[model samples]
Target: MTTSSGSSSHVTDARGPLHTGPGDQHIYYGDIRASASSDRSGRDPRQVAVEELRALRRRFVDPVGSDRARELLEDKRAVMLTAGRGHGARTAAKVFLCQLPQGSRRFRELVDQAEEGDSAGRALDREQVERGAALLLDLSTVSSRRYETFMAELPWFLKVVRECDAWLAVVLPALWRAGFEHVFRGLVVRLERPDPAAVLQAHLRDVGIHVRRAEVAVPELEHELTTATMAQTADLSEDIRAARENAPPGSGFAAWLKTALAARAPGAQDVEAHLSGLDSGAQRALLLTTALLHGARTDTVHEAAARLARAAELPEVATPLLHHRTLTARLAEIKAAAHRGRVRFTVAGYDAGVRRWFWDNYPQLRGPLADWLRTAPGFTALERADRLELVTRFAHERLRTGPPDGLAALAERWSGPSASPEELTMAARALGEGVVHARYGSHFRQQLYRWAQDTALPGHRAHVVIGVCSEVLSRRFPDQAMIRLRHVSRHREQGVRVTAREALARITDSDDRLYRSLLKRLAPGEEPRGLRDLGIFLHVADPARMAGDATVGALLADHWTAALAHLPPRRWEQPLRAWLERAHTRPVARRPALRALATACARQRAAFGAVYAAACSWAAGDPARRRTVNALWEAAGSVPRPQPSRTAAAAR
Candidate 1:
């Protein structure tokens, strides 16, 4: 063997046996295979694999690397093929191939070595084919058993092979022969499906060479283990069923009621007799169901109570029915009073304390209240808004002190026209308290959005509707609030716009931080892009007030056109057209407000052009009116537009 330093080959004892020690300098597969057991004895398995790896590295890499050693060994192929002229050379090639990286390097070397023979006069024989098969088995055992070492060295091995393209065209026909197919198939399974050498997998299928997949016995073994243990489980289940069938008869209330009621006893006369035999818990369950069933009337309740008293020989039969006898009686009384269309109770008297008392014991009172509220003629006749306000106030007050019981149902019924500001306020209050019910959330958000856009509502009240939306609904319903804030930012009223801008500021807090950083870098006279998109420009508080500060006034004036045009014409008309129509007739004291409106309207001349045209039409044939229309147009022109930045240009 040639040494890495280009020294002559070492003299051997005609080789007695190869030693795996550092002083050893010969390769012997037979000696190494036998020494494996002794080398591994009383040693860590990982340490043994490491020691064996170092020996193989010394034999392979030290001999001018595996590629050169493989070429030198293949040079003796003609002699090795003839009788035993180069047996040692063939053995060296097999050992060297086993030490190389699995598929890419080893398989390519085998095919390349065979192809060289075709170019020359040599042809592959059974000896070379057997050597290749044995080398694959040995390598597979190392990879399948000592996986840690193979994986640790794989990255460097692949890096070496990938730097060359010569291996791409080679194919190993020896692997497709009988008895050698499994080695190729096993490598294909172990590699990724898109591996560079995946053509080998197609070749195997084309040649009809099938390697049976390994049987996966893990799930089957688990089933057998479970089946063995489940025999006792099956027997236990049957025994439980038999016990349920053969058990003694029950003397519980349901059993006794079944027997007593089966007789029918001419109109359930013995229901009280049956009740007397049950425990107190059973008695409460029975009477509560009976009183709430809608079939039981006032007389039926009294008769049932009287019969229980006679049968039990007590002064009275006590249950929640007897405890809240007044509320129960009031339930029956409400029907008659509700029919007459008047149930006298002052609204002031129904305070939080009264609401709390009813809800504190809601379980006992909900059924009767629900029955009266649903069935009472007066409840049905009450104005929709009034009824909604009543129940909503009750629900809000009750939820203020406890979890949402049945009050959400009452609040949900107040949809459509009944969803007033007061109703929305109550719903907002419930939401802020973390009372998350599906009914009060999205439906109420839709109602709040409609109310905010309702032009018929006075400006102050409409402002209040949105104030509740921003203050309470922003956290849970942020997207809805953002849409509303975008539309309302240009409201005709300065106070309402200021409120909306403040709400927009609260909702976009994180984005505003980023905008603030970019705002600092803006040139003194240049407008920032996406100013309206970031919603920062919406903070135009009382344009008259902002006009006093030159910096803020300049900022608004610069982006005024872009901001106003961001929303379309249809949106501005709802809140703005009415104000603009009277812009010409307003007193001189209101000129600043009118001028501010003109700044926004003048931005989108195409959309608001009609409004300006209508003003000019109304101004026709009157010099004074025409002069006012001309002044409005002049005011619109006077509002500033951003100049091209001289400072930015100079710096650039």
Candidate 2:
């Protein structure tokens, strides 16, 4: 149960061309079906989110204004929550959205205009506000100008929300509350900071720590609680949990609390003190290695430390390995220890502290550190989990201290042409960390977008990007994931293209809105890429994959009309045959499929002639096949044709 980052942009309604190239015809329907089935067998993202939300709910303490906020959300379907920083406003917003009965509706965080690309100036796209959706629009980080733009569009956005019967919870910046109070008089709910001790207690209890209230109400703890943010309190509980786990047998809660509190003390001074005691570059490199791979086997950590030292060009002593200090002595010097073959810091949170100290104090070493991480995880003695954990730790520290470019560059390097399996996994893990980072996710998403569009992207890099887009980004940012997948589906590499298409098909098959959205984006037009677009369209548009609802019927009709008018019969004939086969086998899909085809034909007589010719061709031989085609054709012709209005005619 992990938290996702904020400040993502909304997906635009602009329909883009999906052009798979000349060999797209090779992407058979069977390939798509196999890919979709495989994808379904994997973990579902929605379930993961729900479980995370449930975990958060276990630790949530209602703030002072939460009751009123809930009332506003329930009665009016939208609420603007205002609280100063560190009041857990974002957490509260998620909790509020989670309170809504999920049903089939999605719980999504909307990207604001500030983050949205070309559509930044427009109101929220009405199409994205699906009915019964529980939405969160976080404006806490937007500029005043962007906030004002959003305010100007609030009326239209609210109109769409109401029309769709959706719920929205907006977390507003407290600084601008006074400025916009008049505009949103009834819609705003000003929240007071909740009791920090209560938050701590809830978190502790959530981790199975139960104690009397009086036991935790001591003055030393009280002072810290008074000053600590809700997030800090939660961290305190986590530290306490860790401390308890590491404490000697028979250690009590009081002992654990004391240790946890000390760990929370200003860590920079402690880290600086420990570094001052280390006498050599080798020792310092070992400390950094242990910090990054905190719990790896002592031997693995030693090898990684040696690798880091060499990569950073740290001069080693001329003394022989046996003549130099032992690994045990070095570990003691760094205030770390090895127990049961694994190494970790003596202090509960000291590893993270050491990581921060190095990342902050010596910015020059950042490049060397990144380089070391690229290859250090490939130690033969390191297990898969150890390698991935090392990459994860490095990604966290790098993203925390610098711009995302460094991490993004490392991902590319690791996934380059000569990358090993371990290097590729490192690349995937690093990019995944960036995707889920609270501050830098949007930056990483942009990187993914660029990589998806790179024609010369190596197959390995393409593979990593596709995996992250499908497994990582798709969970929290499905729309962005879909956009990237669509781009990758057009890659020059055939296997990459097929994998991308499979991800697209799997995603759309499970969500009808996305299916329609994909259709609109791939809709045929005057674009010269009609052949490829039609191929992709036919691949995902299996009649057996869609529900027999009127909405799906209408979307199919509209797209079929454009595809029929623009594409040659040969480009779509196989898919048409597939759909006809489904209509013949599945009673429920028969009428809707035929009627959609008929509607397309009625809208374009040339399309009707094409369909007639294809059907006649298919009916040429077998008696059973002829009977099915004749019955489908007769039924399709009987369906009513929509009349073109005079206004439509004049506009055309």
**Model 1 scores what on Cα lDDT?**
0.34
lDDT of 1 by residue, 1-652 (tens): 0011111111111211111111222122122212212122433222232244333333321212334434533432210111112112222333444443331112212211111223342222222221122122112212122233333333343233333311111111222222322222322211111111122122222334222222112343224223232222223223333433444575332232233222222222233343355554424332432332223334433343344333434345356854654534443332211223333222112223233443454455545544343322132233433333344454554455544544444433322244544343333333333222222333344444555554444443445445444544443333345555544543545455555555554443322211221222222222322433323343322232232233333333334444455544443332333333333344432365456556655655564575466556666668876776777778777765434222111100
Segments of candidate 1 deviating more than 4 angstroms? 1-358, 361-393, 413-560, 563-582, 587-615, 633-640, 643-652
RMSD of every prediction:
34.8, 7.0
TM-score of 1: 0.29
Q: Candidate 2, after superposition: displacement of residue 361 in Å?
A: 2.6
Task: Give the worst 10-residue stretch by lDDT in candidate 1.
Answer: 1-10
Candidate with top TM-score is 2
Clashing pairs in 1: none
